[model samples]
Target: MPAITAENQLALPRIERPGPESRPRPAWLVTTARTQLEGEGFQVRRPFPGLEVGIADPFLLLDHIGAVEYAPGEAKGAPWHPHRGFETVTYMIDGALEHHDSTGGGGYIADGATQWMTAGAGILHDEVPPAWLVQKGGLFHGVQLWVNLPASMKWSPPRYQDIGARAVTLLASFDGGALVRLIAGELGGHRGPGVTFTPITLAHVTLAPGTRLETPWRRDFNALVYALNGRGRAGEERRPFGEGQLVVFGNGDHLVVEADELQDARSPNLDVLVLGGRPIREPVVFHGPFVMNSREEIVQAIRDYHAGRMGHIPPTRMDFSHLVGEHIDQDRGGTRR
Candidate 1:
């Protein structure tokens, strides 16, 4: 788990313990994740969207990509695709990935880094392992989340944010038993680097064995806890869940997660992605790469993509014609050869 860490977690700022008035959310539902091949033959563990869309509202999908080691010539990644009316957040924990899009915004994301792409209106997108990583394969672990945009902001504008590893907010549990990395939204008066159209909170937490994490949560937002690795108990009811499992919490002021005392040596700590968002209670029609409110709107998005209404990918080769050396002829006004 290369996702940011602290040698001395006790030295980090502590998240104030939830007061007595704060009620711990109860475990409403729990399910095991399903493994499937995604994007160019890469495998992913998806835990939601299998549940009711209304339950995970404002969130369309969550794909947990490898914590798997790969040999040379075995690495894979997503190819060119189109998206509209939502945001895609790629958090790279252990390996590198190259991202580029029609908006000319992208770069390498690795080692606890994050790339947030808001395909609001529309955009052509591509993300793949770098040639170096592909040629000499190594471990890769990451998460890609699809966040839905409300109908009002669905066509605002396409934007991209490269949130470096160090930019995330880090905090510790009241007793220093857990390390909290805040990727987006607000928590205990501390805010993350990610900006969102919908109110949300995204955090990666590592809980040491036998430690319980009780954190404040917004009553307005839907709460979900997904285990990235290791076994753990969730909510006030203490529902048992393990790797690739997800827990949905009922409305409350706070939530609880406690790591099991006995964990597999493969992953010694319970690492979980804690997330919640204000539900956009509108009708959701998710078809292919488009997330819209109506079927007709989805149809329109597809037609627009085919008609090139979405942005276009830039040419691979650099254009030196605009540079100093390949200047146009002023006398004849001819094109540079």
Candidate 2:
């Protein structure tokens, strides 16, 4: 569920309606997410860099974190980990996650806040729920997206963008049936606050039940619609989809999704994350936390990380010892000890 909402969406600026000539992007592929344990054993639904689609170009992985509730002392999170050659965008929708960046970018991204970290050359960090959430227990629902960087800028420098919920740009569809939370990129002449090395558009869209939403999309960028919750139909053909389903759209300047006339009690509306970037189109060699252009570059990244070149773990952060002796095949997407 989206943590931010407007009492009156009508009062918000409306996204201009796509003209009749605007080509509607048709749903090319639709796939469901696979549940898997990540980090320190928290369950996540990963939809891409996946079997259905090896990669989403410029975007690597999409992890849909829990809409699940946790009991006291049952909460878990990722311990100290290293990442390189990309950016990590974590958006907290309901609960909070405290981030400890070795680069002094630590903060609490709770209730619709975003932690955008650019692991340019490399960086080490840990993400965990706050002490209160861990000890008291409560609801936790969020998303962590991995955006790939072009080879030219992969080693630029480690940077962080702490986008508070208040900083998010809220927009309404042309007919006012949807609320679009612009996390990054531009839409209908409006721009979000996120800065990116790659050209992309990222927005959390909430479609009111029984309503239809159609908006103009950048023809240059790829289009993706990920159902975070609720039921919906996508494309001109009205292909039915539900929560955890990822819809990839084909070439067009317009995008569309229609919320079901009735939705589940828990999700009264269709909420989908709409994101797509200009394809990097370069060779991708992924191994563990490292994404590089070649297997040699991936190996170099691992060696650098082990040699303390990425960043140092702070004394206060907890170490889970998760990375030792794990060797993953760069192209096979498999891990071998």
Leading candidate by TM-score: 2
lDDT (Cα, tens digit) per residue for candidate 1, span 1-337: 7788987899988889999988899999999888877665788898878897599988989999979898998888766667889999999989899998888999999999999999999987778898888899899999999999999999988999999999999999888999999999988778999999999999999999999898889889999999999999998778999999999999889889999999999999999999999999999877667788998998798788778788776777123113211111121221101
In model 2, how large is the Cα lDDT of residue 231?
100
Best by lDDT, which number? 1
- TM per candidate comes to 0.93, 0.94
TM-score of 2: 0.94
Clashes of each: 0, 0
Cα miss at 151, model 1 (Å)? 0.5
lDDT tens digits, residues 1-337, model 2? 6478888999999999888889899999899998988765789888887744333888888899889899998788876777889999999999999887778787999988999999999888878889899999999999999898999999988999999988999999988999999999998899999998999999999999988888888877888999999999999999999999999999999998999999999999999999988888888877777888998998798789779898886666534444432322222353110
Model 2 regions lying over 4 Å from their true place: 51-55, 318-337
